[model samples]
Target: MPELERDNEVELAYGVRLRSSGVSATVGDVRQAPTATRPVRGVVADELLGDSGDAVARLLPVVEAAGMRTVLAVPLDDVQVPPTPFGGVRALTGEENYVELSVPGPDPDEGQVVLEVDEVGLVRWHIDVEAAATAVAIADNGTALAARGVAPVRAGIEQTFRIPIVQLDQGGVGGQQRGFLGFGVRKVLHLIRFPIEAAAAAVGKAVVGWWEDRRRPHALSLVTPESLGDVPPPDGVSAARLAELADKPFLVLVHGTFSTIRSGFAGLNRSGGGQPDLAELVARYEGRVLGFDHQTLHVDPTTNADWFLRRLPTDRPVTLDLLTHSRGGLVGRRIADPALAAAAGVPTPDVRRLIHVGTPNGGTVLASPKRWTTLIDVFTNLFSMLPEEVATPTAEAVIELVKQVATGVFNGLAGLTAMDPGNPAVTAANAQVFGGGASGAAGAVRAITSDFTPAAEDLRLRALNAIVDPFFGTGNDLVVPTQGVFEAGDYRVTDPFVVQSPSAVVHTAFFSDVRVRAKLGEWLPGAV
Candidate 1:
């Protein structure tokens, strides 16, 4: 390698080329230098640049003054896994640590010539490919410490650099010489998610739940409110509130996930004006619209259902019509269960109708580790379950392994865990209400589900669908698949309205669909 000699100090420089797939390009200018370099040695704590900044910032003054240009960027836009038959292949890149530092040597006018680089940034990648690297990671000499968060997963990549072998007295360009020198290596950061620790915990819990399901599955039948533990006492509707129902029925509007009274049922207040939200509009259909806001993240659906039932007005001025969105659908079905309603002190027949919009009755692809594993298990089991041998492996058995492997990848967050359709607790409750083909209490309560989504029409949605469509299916309202709102036997009992429109009705926008309110009014018989 050709080196630069100025004031007796030698600075090494080299040229590099990047190749991936079938395309190739030189590295882009470092938009931002990474903070840490791999193969860390004797360096003090304060010098590390991990928390908020890049390590390149510290080296820019020295490297720039040395007259060298540096650049970095992901070739081909993104390093993504190729799609496969089991839906979209979901292989994640571990860490890309190999950083190619390209430096142009000093001009002939500078008069001094000589050189060899002692270090190159780290080369990090999946364990499978880590061994096949050509770079070395090393620390800078005394005092000049590397920044933070920039340690490549795999280090010590070896490579050769091409430098021009020049004549000391020459003014014009001359022949080239190739030399292999190791440059300081920095780690690559994927700043899109939570810390590694939190992610691991989520996966651990998800796996435990997945395994637990086989040991004890959900009842999938009517359960009493008393059975739903830790459910907060139901909020009671005042006499004035019940009196308002005299004009119509009790239109209970329940919100799912992260929403509150004002933001959810009450409808958010926009700048100048806004249309009535689900609660307000649905109220017009039969009677007074009441909001059911529960702590979604920590509490599961059953617990929330317990709280939901208790909050109701003891004696209604009118009949009851239950309407729910997203996760709210889970609670709605539980409420419609004859056993649960009776336990809550209301006659099962008193709660007459169930209307669900964008409910994840089947399961949610997002945060439902069991669902993702189910994606793999479904296809694997399809072929695995062909044989009917008594001692042979079964699909149910395979689900445990698949779920463990899959859910273990992402710890089950409390909210996601509670609503996970695959979880025994959630599945048991659902099966009791939705699985066996009827919408609670046989023909006692009439039920209907309306699903609306624009699909992958927009560019952003298209990109997102590319990643999730494999699990959630192609038709989704961004969060849950519109079809997931309905179970396998749902059509046998509940009337389904799957809107096919070129116009997109996004997740939050489902409440704004004029058709939903109108349909509720038509389907809902006037007061009892």
Candidate 2:
């Protein structure tokens, strides 16, 4: 310990080193001229810094006049955790009380230092290692008081300073130092995400409840046999006659991301600059329309698709046409399941026609790789695991736990080489969806291989495949990729224009430029 003497007053300073345990001090600073170094006495407030803003603000002035250039004042970054001092102050006033104050000393070990302050307001510190700690957290009796987001108290009277040590790495990763004195301790914060399975289960239960309430009343009324009660159609409504054929060749339109079925209806109710609703487009041609809803943000893509497919009515023979966008193409592809069709109480669909507008056959690159997966997981979980009002700090803790668990699972699976291919769960997601994967199956393989980028030059091939390739080998639109838009067994639209089958014209528009939507009414009479 070094003692400073001036004007009949002697300032004594001592040092203390801490790791994980509350530190103890032998000689607290004593500024009285007698030079009697004694342990200062004060109760450690369960709270770190006392509630005196003015005292904290006046700290620099008092320490500066005492010849001390550096003061350690730990501000609370997170109230729920410990307080860390990343900021520096000049000095402390005699009024603040601290039995023992930990200071960064001259000698540092492994880039670390330890120091202690006494009542004299003089600080004795030592560095043991070459690495200088970047930050410190202050606490009282193990209670963190101030650190990021907590403003320094502005009072001018007596003031005390305490801080938790924080270490900064070259790569940007940061850590807190173990507590050295009094009740101050180190704590860390982490980012979190929602658990897919847990959230799905919760929403699944909710949807099931909703189904029980609305199922019977709705009962696929679009296809239910209802005697046309001789009632006349409303004056402005033009679907009077088509209402009879609504039960046959029912058309269900599934909107893609961010769009709702009501969107089309709203558009029909109100004219817009964009394309008109299929109802109006088909109304003149006597076509009927049906819309389906599936969870958007709260549900996973494959699960949502499965739910939508199972909800379809397939009990009797039926010709179903589908129009989808974005990831909706995946829904259409999955619904081709014979079992799902049967479960929907509808006959196997006659494989009539399918149209996908701006569908992402493969996963989007934006959701691929590591960072994006974490981001999506976080966002989806925010809506899933937390109520709107729960403190973000609490929710964040929960989410972080979920993400850690998910990451562990992802890593475990990623270690595997062989796995079932047909299992829907096994094949549905990307290994890195939450992070990493096993065998690089459906989700994993796609995440690893697909290029979902926005760069223009790379898009030429993708755009060509998206529009022309679906008809490859036998024929193609030359825009959609063959492997994506077209199924393995389908050749109807693939046949050359002249050799085209009877369904060619009906499916022609599918392989042709999207402009064909304008003339669809020619064949279907009312479907435009």
Candidate 3:
């Protein structure tokens, strides 16, 4: 263990070094329990790990058995790493490179530590041949504060990494303000190593699990009044249920990205302040409502539509009405594409009515490759601030995506890319759905969009808007451009519902608004 003296560089265990002029700090082996625990104050371990804490509990024994060591840093005061230049022509010539870490002063309002770098400097580490290095900040409770992958400068033996400057405080979480760093809260930093193949495999497994659990890929479930807000059953509706609804017009619920039926539409089950409950629509439709849970990350909307069509009962003709949110609108449009329907050999002549709430029909700039990191940053903050409104599983998925992106392994995620304004899929889908006429078989499409600008009092939200608004260059509901939902290419929704500014109706909170509910009642009054 060593203390960082002002203006002097201190070498610590594991080839690590620290030099700072204005802060008191200590660096020690993380395996020393007390030293590791000191910095991670105020973190609720259960919140970071699962309630059981089984993951770490299981790892400690193995670490002790192998006699491994990890380094920990505790900053007694605000710290700054003087500007250092390391990567340039030397790096191009296969030489060592350096990176600086910029640690910001603690902000009482934000309870996390954020790692940033003004210039590219690599933190080099010697690791096992099979391992990949990563820099991670962890809260006492085990929540990941920030993580960045290390790039190998020399394969197997040497690695270099720069902590990305990611701002994770944009909104209030559970009514309280919090940042990704947990700054004021105690925190610890670790340069961890894991088998590259194993890490990749685990991420792949987690992605599959997230898609299986939340997306339910091509599954359809009966949404009854009693089950309006419940998670769709794993097995979906049985054949008997399909037979019972044969030849009847049904309303299909198509949820947005990283969402399940319950996560997307559950708000409809509750009402207040004289606001009408969406459940009334379920009863009104004579219980002929269905929820389509499908993949929204790895596959494009057309693929999702293809799967949905394949699962429909071919013995009977089906007519559909659609209620979609966010990217779901694209899938709904694809489902309604007459050509796709013909290809699937299903005689779905037209969607009787389609109601798009926060749907990115035209596409969103956030989905573009350059904006992927920003997209994840926005969602991370939003999830923290509006936990109840955002889907929980999606947060985990975003974290995984971050790791993948940091490692330079992220492909433009196909499902999200489909929403990119410049993506070919967006152009193709819009041309086919709106090309022939204003009303393709999607029939009478109406939209619910919002121009959401946070109020002056909502500092964090305003901050988030500041970061996101530039990309849109227009009004948006945080994730989707306001105009994009109703107009694209050759189409313009004649009288789309607009949730004007000065309102708190974000993309996720659209269905929770009284005005939106009332509009739903007006548009889809059910079986009448």
TM-score, one value per model: 0.48, 0.32, 0.68
- Alpha carbon lDDT of each predicted model: 0.37, 0.28, 0.56
The TM-score, computed over Cα atoms with residue i paired to residue i, of candidate 3 is 0.68
**Which prediction has the highest TM-score against the true structure?**
3
Residue 503, model 2: lDDT of: 22
Best by lDDT: 3
Estimate candidate 1's alpha-carbon lDDT, on a 0 to 1 scale.
Answer: 0.37
Q: Write the number of the candidate with greater lDDT, choosing between 1 and 3.
A: 3
Per-residue lDDT for 1-528 in model 1, tens only? 222121122222123233222111222222222322211121122222222122233322322322222222221122122233543223211122122223222121111111111112211111112211211111111111122121222222322222211111111213422211111111222111001122323453343343333332222111112221111134335545554554555666666654333333321222112344333343355435555655444446766776555545556423567767777777777776666666877545345567777777776655353233323322222222122221012222332323222112233234555555545565555545342345764233333343333243232233233334554545766566666666533333345776554654555545445555455556555454
Best-to-worst order by lDDT is: 3, 1, 2
- Pick the winner on TM-score between candidates 1 and 2: 1
Each model's total of backbone clashes:
50, 92, 17
By TM-score rank, best first, the candidates go: 3, 1, 2
Any runs in candidate 1 off by more than 4 Å, and if so which?
1-248, 264-287, 313-318, 345-349, 370-414, 433-437, 441-457, 489-492, 524-528
lDDT per residue (tens digit) for residues 236-342 in model 3 = 88756776776567888999986777777867777775665756777777888888988777678888998788767767767788999898988888888777777
lDDT of 1 at 47: 29
